[model samples]
Target: MASFKKTATGWRADVFKKGIRRSKTFRAKREAVAWSNQIEYEIEQGHHDTGAAPPNATMYHILERYRDDVSPKKRGARWEVTRLNQMMRDPLLADVKLSDVGPRHFSAWRDKRLKEVSGSTVNREFNLLTHACKLAWREWQWLKEHPMAGVSRPPENKPRDRVITDAEIESYVETSGFSFKTPPATVLSRVGAMFLFASETAMRGGEICKMKKTDIDFNKRVVYIPETKTGVPRWVPLSTKAIKILNHVLDYTKGTPTVFCVTASQRDALSRKIMKKAGLEGINFHDTRRTALTRLSQKFGPMELAKISGHQDLKILQSVYYAPDPSDLVEKLE
Candidate 1:
């Protein structure tokens, strides 16, 4: 049961159920009614929590705990850590106490962040925050109710359909300081080989960086990927060109365990520098997957392409990766 009274400052609502009492003061009577009703409902459902979080516990602390205890177990730990660090820097979201945190803070944050970044970026952050809050509410019992339950996610930006060209690929490789005649010996040469190899193999930048020299089966023309974005291992068949590039990289970095000597971050930085030097715009390293899949589609059917690309969802494989030129389709139609 709940009761409300008009106070000098605002409306004060008090709820008592299951021998537990909760009270809150809101600026408006409607707000008080809403809060009291929610409390009563939670009590009836046996989900009410009268205690757990410390008096001064803030969203920052929850996020910090999540970063240390949860994020490291994920495959995208690097990205999650980076995003969580950025989130903690914002005082509006980080400093708010668990009891006082509500949808308004997140709504304000979303509005401000939309001005600086794309909707997709903010949505990713929202996902991380949502999961953190869920854990706090259900697993950690840090909040009486989910704070983010009332907040709506921002509209996602359209997916990237930017396709890379062969000429641009050649220019990117040439600008990366790798030469066909000379063996790949420098880090820049390895980056170049990574770029070319991405086009041939469609392996992600991280996967390429994590590639072990021992994983390559030259006899079978296949490379076994023990770790992947999908968390499932798959054997990616190597093309003749891919094998040649691997052999070139092997000749130089033989002492190292990994094929490519650069981390994903290093590959991204060097790739951006090379792309800028090549005068290319709007093409990212991941675009190589789209380009490679488009080229692979010319020879392999949907099932075979899915196998090679490690895409369990054929619809995603077709919609996102298999980008064919209209002119090429027309040529084939003739």
Candidate 2:
């Protein structure tokens, strides 16, 4: 027999038969009912494993299950799914059995990864795998112990202070074939407009890509972000320059619900292409946040800056996003 109940998080399904019990929670009632039905069917056919881990299960198997079952529930599901898929493609990690996986495998992977990417990238990947291992050990019963428990994380890297200058923004825009007179009809032109908008607004690339036309209130000069990286909703007050950029984008993307026609991946790819064409190096789309936040800091106090940047931690906002020129500070002091 199966029973279903609504919980604060979602729906919970419980199945019991022949002295065996299974339970799971899902974000939707349909998913819960489907899982319970599958469990009941397996039990009736005697195919269900009575609390025993599969003999041939591997690290890849655990991560695959996590990617499919857990990642979709997260706010950063797209990035998590992409990274999990990339990790599973590695034969060294994928082929190792769950019982055989230990600190040594991850340690080797960490060292090899450092040679290919930055310490920051390695640390993010480590955090993802660590969580996956923890869930597999505690909840899934796929491992006897946590595989990442013995592994050491890479050293934290210095936070990026790269601030995009006004001249560089112009160069990028010119190289991307966009001008004030031109319509933002092409992907490159739209991406350039997005870059300019980021510098004026300090919105993240993902947030900008997810924006809809209805989110903006021109009369109020505010944009409502329903979903943010921190999972908190915020209203970002707009500047005159930011409003001008929004109006330009609105003109081209008329009739579409989305404010920007480009996807996040397209924006990223086109950004790289335009930057290279402009002969710019070492600057990324995210640097616009630092630039805009730093510029905004001159006009607004720390508390106001935190609200605009969607940063919950003032320490992070000060340390990471607020990069000021020493010359400007000296002038202010004088």
Q: Distance (Å) between predicted and true CA of 20, model 2?
A: 13
In model 1, the Cα lDDT at residue 129 comes to 94
| Per-model TM-score on C-alpha atoms | 0.83, 0.85
- Rate residue 303 of model 1 by lDDT: 95
Q: Which has the greatest lDDT? A: 2
Model 1 RMSD to the real structure?
11.8
Model 2: which ten-residue window has the lowest total lDDT? 48-57
Which residue pairs show backbone clashes in model 2? none
How do the residues 1-334 of candidate 1 rate in per-residue lDDT, one tens digit apiece?
8888996567878777887666655789999999888878877887755644434678887887788679999999989988887787789788898879999999988998999999999998999999999999899888888988889888888777878999999999998888768977777768889989999988888899999988999999999998887778999999999999988878878888788777788888888989988899999999999999899889889999988888999888888888899999999978
* Candidate 2 residue spans exceeding 4 A from truth: 1-52
Poorest 10 consecutive residues by lDDT, candidate 1: 48-57
**Pairs that clash in candidate 1:** none
Candidate 2, residue 239: how far the Cα is off, in Å: 1.2
